[model samples]
Target: MTRRPTPLKQWRLRAASLALTLPLSLAVAAANKPAQGDYFERIATFPVYHNLAEGEARATETVAEITTASSDGSTLYYTDSPRQRLGLVDIRNPEAPRPAGFLQLEGEPTSVATHRHFILVAVNTSLDYARPDGVLAVFDIRDPRAPKRVASLATGGQPDSVAVSPTGRFAAVAIENERNEDLNKGLLPQFPAGHLNVVDLAGQPADWRIRKVALSGLAKIAGEDPEPEYVSINALDIAAVTLQENNHVVLVDLRRARVLHHFSAGSVDLHGVDIEENDRIQPTASLLGKRREPDAITWVGPLLATANEGDYKDADKVEGGSRGFTLFDPRGKIWHESGASLEQALIRAGHYPESRSENKGIEPEGIASARFGKRQLLFVGSERGNLVAVYDASKPWSPRLEQLLPTGVGPEGLLPIPSRNLLVVSSETDAADDGYRSTLSIYRLGAKRAEYPQIQSDPKQLLPWGALSGMVADRDARKRLYAVPDSYYKASRIFRIDAGRTPALIDGEIELHKGGSSVDYDLEGIAQAGNGDFWLASEGDGKKRPNLLLRTNASGEVLREYALPEAVAAQATSNGFEGVAVTGEGALERVYVAFQREWRNDPAGQVKIGVFNPNNEQWRFFHYPLDQAPDGAWVGLSEITAVDDERFLVLERDNRSGPDAEVKRLYGISIAGVEPQADGTTLPLLRKRLVRDLLPDLAASNGWVPDKVEGVALDTRGELFVVTDNDGVEDASGETRFLRLGRLRP
Candidate 1:
């Protein structure tokens, strides 16, 4: 029997939804549903690199763009445009997907779909923008192991999307005669207009014939060049198509091979959004009349949903993209619009791409809808944020945001299989050097609640935050903790978190300031004082800034700043002052600051730990031994947490992610009777013992293991917590794994 969430747990989930900045209606709807109801949980992440031939170089660029599942839901197929191939994955056991090799295609596979035992691949064989051409290649996958090419038909032009009708009578292809951005700045009307191609799927594959349906002169903007981007066929033999670049939506009667209705995708005035690339997440900017250039469309029941992923900007600097998704009726009446809420929710989950703020926030690109038993589910993929926002579409008019699942970089495909209770997402971006390989993530629907968004802020406050670095638990509060963001943002802040909840909540924040003016610091470490104040350790840039220890009041007002002694500061490097912790009280109080790496004068395999005495205002140093890092990688201290007056814990990790990582652990040190050197010269080496190995905990998430395990804290009841730094989502996966290590003895 499925166990329902208790009243307290339900309240926490509701508060979490609000904290995630979900739409008000969505929050209420999600909270009111039975807790034991259906929900999707991520099961596995299959990297496309694994699909390469056994001896082939893994570093070779590969991507999984558009994906589709077999009718039996036993196998997965995706397009690899860069390699001009169709990759396969056997997901008979959805929890552990295995690579099933790949099939080389003649041209770039733009899209993929499955009907019965046939795999339809849209191959883009276009020579150029003026001369666009493509083929719909069909492969018989009846054997499931070895698929053979059966037949191929010429699509009217470059086909971007293909969909088979529910009755398997016909198939609709969006022949997008795409334009070249280099020519005329990619301005519209660049040649032959695009149209819809309907293929008769009756009889055999060789008997199929394409029928062109003119879609020209149907949109207000760039009507002569209608570039259809995506298509979805409903049960009534109707096709819903999205002309992304032209900002238009069109409906076609597949049975008649003619256009039924077309309407402008329109524009939206987005407010409460961040529209700057200024190294901060301030949602105070507004964009007036931004075009909703919907890229992907799907039919949910009788309604249509669009993922408005804008791609063009006019000469007047009129940008595209409404930063969200929209649900509309057949006649183009807006039934529900996500507006800026989705982007805001990504912000709360630390997945918002701040660098893309000036262009498109999150960029909802691919959308798919499927019915699981009695409930309808909608999945919206974020291209920039690298995640999918799942919604309950049981009520088509008012969809409820249910959960957000992390994906690979640039998710461009969303495929749901209700029969197998699985959803597959495919990513397009392939950057082997950056540790972000193209991947296909699989999720399964079950009774368990979401296990992501481990930390979030209150929606009522609408706090925009990310790049969490240091953490410190309150002395009196059982579940209260404090965390600080690194130099990712311009404003330095200390956030208050409620650690008791299953998915922790950030309930409040205090921006650091001095004399009515904000002060920005690369704060990597934080420690709470007995009087409720905070001690922060700011890292130096090695060029202009020097490492320093700062004291702040409970209200986040800086009271004092103590630079490293002149002699000690001269030997500092860029990786300095990573962690800070305080012990004792009054005159006996001593501050411990951990330097991340070896300094100019320190010996190899040892970093200095600066000790400060508040009573005498003197400084001492101790050398901490470092572990040997993997080749081309460096190990360093990330955090320090005080266990008591005599002992403390320090986080040590390597600058490697995914499968390359090796050193994510905690070390214990005691200063009960040891004496430190007065200066860096011949510093005393401190003895350390292994506390815990955190690599297993991070690997249990079924995703890539993040490298920046930069935060650690111990609460009053012996609960230990940890957090990772996402590098502000710049060339990174933007996944923060907030882990609780339960009770521990230092």
Candidate 2:
């Protein structure tokens, strides 16, 4: 018998394999894609609430957890556990998927699988954790609108995952008698143990028999109690089951109804990863000998891929999550372990969830494999990151990351339809108050490159960056841009972006330092002066942090700080000092700051624009008229850019996102003849002209419209640029859209 490789040996082997087989180009394209080859582009997004039954309140929560498609791959069926219904969708028109309807189920549906004209649904009907009971309900899906339940077989325990064999003769369900997390901190070995339920799908549906396969004594950690989380069947009718909390993986021979082999899912040594929740994404920590408690598993030929989600935490607060994924051979030998690559890839794309660093970074929880033409593909879904990673699995031993697709809040279901060259992902998080609803996103595989990640950091010099509050083009370099982050981060740094790339790349960063130590400021805006220095604008709340401006040298060292007049600063709200700009040279130089919303003393629909003369230390103010805002939404200026000494452009937008978004535009304002006033004086309302409306550009991506169009600038070549804030990926889908618009007309 071959001895299983130790964690150190496994790590060394993987590193050697990667060093030999992985190319530099393949490594850099892991988070982004090249400008060639077929890729999946999101074509449509279906709101799960549209499938609500007639007379149902729209405010009620509905989610699409686990999804499955019909044999022909034209219709999709998803489980809505919150509503106890099975939702259906017609995808004949892949670009425009429609809600077919929904069917009320007797119990909460955990998973769904399809074989031929039949659909197998795992329903959890257990009254409590101690007494586990479930049913494998078989339905004839020939008529999807009205799927008739042909038979219901007792599953002996609460089921979590269901799968059908390729032979169409057998179906398997993982009856995971899940434990209540509140009881005893969710220690294992609770009363009734869970097992596997194999359904013999021969003859009539009513004649199907459920065979119980005891999974006890198989795991080395928790032998008495086993909670099977996910199941996948290979071409040989072999079932692969993941006992998540037990930190083990088992293979069952469905033909003989017995265990074929078992192995500990094992742990990995994670290096160069962020392991703390410090509101910063610095990947320089190590998690050695961490258990890989896999959550979802799928077979890639003779190989197995597991999403190590690490859902179990010991009494000492040590979690089993290894913060990555793993690939294993049939003999339990580790083929490859993605230690920190996935999380690093997410960080480059600005999708790394810093809030989840303490538990599981991004939380890889869903996996799907399929063959599109001759290219074998593997997709891994990140639960907290809200994106799916696609990999080329042609060489099973060395899979290359090909693309990253953005999804909703919690992407729980990943289904690939190779017949139509499409992939579907379902998100389960539904909180309308938070502006994120459960959705099913559809994608087609014909694009030359992925449309997402319009902006990303260079993978070679990876650095995590998000919350792009303001941007400004370099005074001399037309292809160079600088952006600053808001209070979302602990330390403020100036990010240097190379705008020449197809998807602009962040290649360098300059940390702002003051008094020999790094400084943490709500740096909202940045403007490069003719002397190569920078004028930084810091937004402030009415109380603690007063609105201020700072002058920084080219190396990002704070030289001086200028606070607003006490009388004017006292009447400001939290939305103060959003954008900043500079004009003229030497004694004639002046700095301008755009306040986001109206101050307490200002009139409604009008905001103040302040100008400061550095030579004289005198301040003057002018008012910028605002556009009519949509109901339940407010509009404000996000950025200010100098078109010339007397002309300027300001980015104005509303707070609503998605379909409700409006008033995102760029307006031109001039100080040609307008006179500015001092504090406690009536300011002149400057006349404004519409420069451009960014709504079409925001909607051109065919995805949800982001509300915060925070940054806009005109480069030295007269070209325009725009960027959106991701709120540092906190309670928001961390997707930063960096767009390069053409030259601006005078």
Among these predicted structures, which one has the highest lDDT? 2
Candidate 2: worst-modelled 10 consecutive residues by lDDT: 19-28
Given candidate 2, what's the lDDT at residue 478?
Answer: 80
Residue-wise lDDT of candidate 2 within 1-746, one digit each (tens)?
11233322222112111221112122112222334657899888888998998899876899999999988888999999999989999988877888899878888999999989989888999999988898888899887656898988888889999999989989999999999888988898786988998999989889998898999998887778999999999877889999999999988879878887788998888888888899999889898888899999998756789999988877787673677788887557787888889989999999998888888888999998988766778999999998899988766556778889988889999999998898999999987777768989898888987787899999897688999999999999988999999988898899999999968999999999999898888988999999999999999988899888999998999999999888888898989999999999999999999999999999999999999999988899999999999987899999999989999999999988777788899988889988899968889999999999999988777676788999887998899999999987777878788887899844
lDDT of each: 0.86, 0.87
- By summed lDDT, which 10 consecutive residues of candidate 1 come out lowest? 11-20
Per-residue lDDT, model 1, residue 266, is 83
Model 1 root mean square deviation, Cα atoms: 7.2
* C-alpha lDDT (0 to 100) for residue 566 of candidate 1: 86
lDDT of 2 at 655: 88
TM-score of 1: 0.94
